[model samples]
Target: MSSKIYSVITGTGIYLPKKKVKNEAFLDFKFFESNGKPVERPNEYIVDKFQEITTIQERRYVADDLVASDIGFFAAKKAIEDAAIDPETLDYIIVAHNFGDVKFGSNRSDMVPALAARVKHKLKIKNPDCVAYDVPFGCPGWLQGMIQADYFIKSGDAKKVLVIGAETISRVIDLHDRDSMIYADGAGATILEGKESSSPVGILTHKTRSDTYRYAEMLTMGCSYNVTEKNKNDLYLKMNGRRLYQYALETVPLSIKACLDKAGKDIMQVNKVLIHQANGKMDDAIIERLYKLYEIDEVPKGVMPMIISWIGNSSVATVPTLLDLILKGSVENQEIKPGDLVVFASVGAGMNINAAVYQF
Candidate 1:
């Protein structure tokens, strides 16, 4: 019998920006409501509340000299080197980002040639056969790109693909919004190489669902909450935090369960759940509910290794960054080995949620 082919994650890398933004950084900034009203609370009290919920004490921010694609290239380079493959050998370069490259001090998004193409150029790969493109699926973009790479490999259309998720949320946030503290900048990349085997070993099953009917506007771009601001062309990332939290808790767990079931694997069989680091508290709730779906009471310790407390939420970059960190033993007490069953899941803008179950 002919063996089936699958795309497995063979190498991973991440680029963390040099600037570390602490919660205290916003102490002097005036926060306001969407309706042009002051928050009325002291900055310290607000910061404390934000930390209690998101658990993000600090997050990385790119230097003014860098942007999303810059970091994406850095991460892609490391992943390519880690895989120890010539860049020209890659069949595809898929970059996952929302705003392309929002330059420092500029609210504009620039993606004329596409970020993937830029990364390809930066990598200096001369192969014309290598296809490069972008995936704009919000926070789940990286995993979605991975799924696409798997399909390309499964169809015998590609051999090795680079999937990267890089975002600079810091550049698109309204300074007056307390939720801005949750934003950060970073990039992560994964190298997926195709392999044929007698049995399935990589990218077993995945699922995705979009809730645009009622949740499309949960996270959107809007003018600064600081009504006194003069610049109208400047847009910032905005969110209805209350609704987003409720939506994620309700759907993210179910999406993960469905993916595991499709893979014929249960929650207990999984060693890790690398979920998007949006809110630490919300992630904990999602896992708790995920365990409850399988009639389990307590979530296994170390099943989900988190970096949000120190990395904040870098939109699409979170999951891949977490995976890279864990694989390199950078995440304390969190590690994965050969044959470990793992799950990657995320929820973000588009009201989108997705999960992929794999055997590592």
Candidate 2:
């Protein structure tokens, strides 16, 4: 008898709004600039200070007519089509998002049924047992959703699971705020299918840690209850950039090493190191630290910096978007072995850090 293989991502798809916002375009906005000068953009100064940091170039945004659910639905359908799986086979759908469809009335979880209904109606699938809900875990939400789906599939309770991370950060962003400048809006999906094999090359090991005691490090709160005028600027995302960076640099490398160690693999065995496309400078520092800690002379150059110039940070959508970019020839000509490991590590707003090891 073969050991239960578990779940693996069979198909991946990403949907970026057709509209592309560039860094140069941001300079024209009065709020994005400093005293009518173009030096206010985060990338402008940060990239110059750090040679390794580059630009995002372009990022997608939802049309004024669209919302987060629309982006989520588009990515989900594409992923389902790519997997060649009927919607009826999808036993579960997990949406990872901090912002939901309705700002006040509906929670993130409420969007799930509507999304499932849309998929059902669009695909015309007759599966009656589909379960759908949202997992609101900030940036690490997508990986957490993946971990949950994996468990459900492994328990023989589900055959096919659709995991999606979608965000419309633009809606909540205080365009006048510098901290919100780095955020954009997008969505991506992955199909995790249950299988029976001896050695499944899917999600191998997962670990997460939280330091919520530092919750104030990044927060958004209201001073008044009135929604009309008093709360006009209450919905924006705020962060202590320096503090968040400290936590990430301190925690993520150890988490990555521990994840690899749990899988009984060495650092050299990993092919791609997919860290959250946070700040380009911070990412470079983390990579350098990792290399020095491991005593490795030559650090691998497959590290992808996805969120620097264009899209900013799309929160949970970052990783899947990075995956899509890699699959779509962004990282072409790179040699990747069959059993090579891929590392996904992220430190999010809740002071949460998570790392997952995958073999491809």
Each model's C-alpha lDDT?
0.92, 0.72
Lowest summed lDDT window (length 10), candidate 2? 219-228
Task: Summarize candidate 1's per-residue lDDT along 1-360 as a digit string, tens digits.
Answer: 678888898889899998898999889999998887999999999999999999999999999999899999999999988899889999999999999999988878999899999999999889999999999988999999999998999998999999999999888889988889999999999999998888878899999999999999999999888754476667888999999999999999999989988999978889999999999999999999999999999999989989999999998899999999998989999899999999999998998888999888
Q: Each model's RMSD to truth, in Å?
A: 1.0, 4.5
lDDT of 2 by residue, 5-115 (tens): 668888888888777876555543434332334344465554333333334554566787777777888888888888998778899888888867634322222355555
Question: Which residue pairs of candidate 2 clash?
Answer: 56-309, 56-310
Whole-model lDDT, candidate 2? 0.72
**lDDT for residue 328 in candidate 2, whole number 0-100:** 59
- Among the numbered candidates, top lDDT falls to 1
TM-score, candidate number 2? 0.84
TM-score of each: 0.98, 0.84
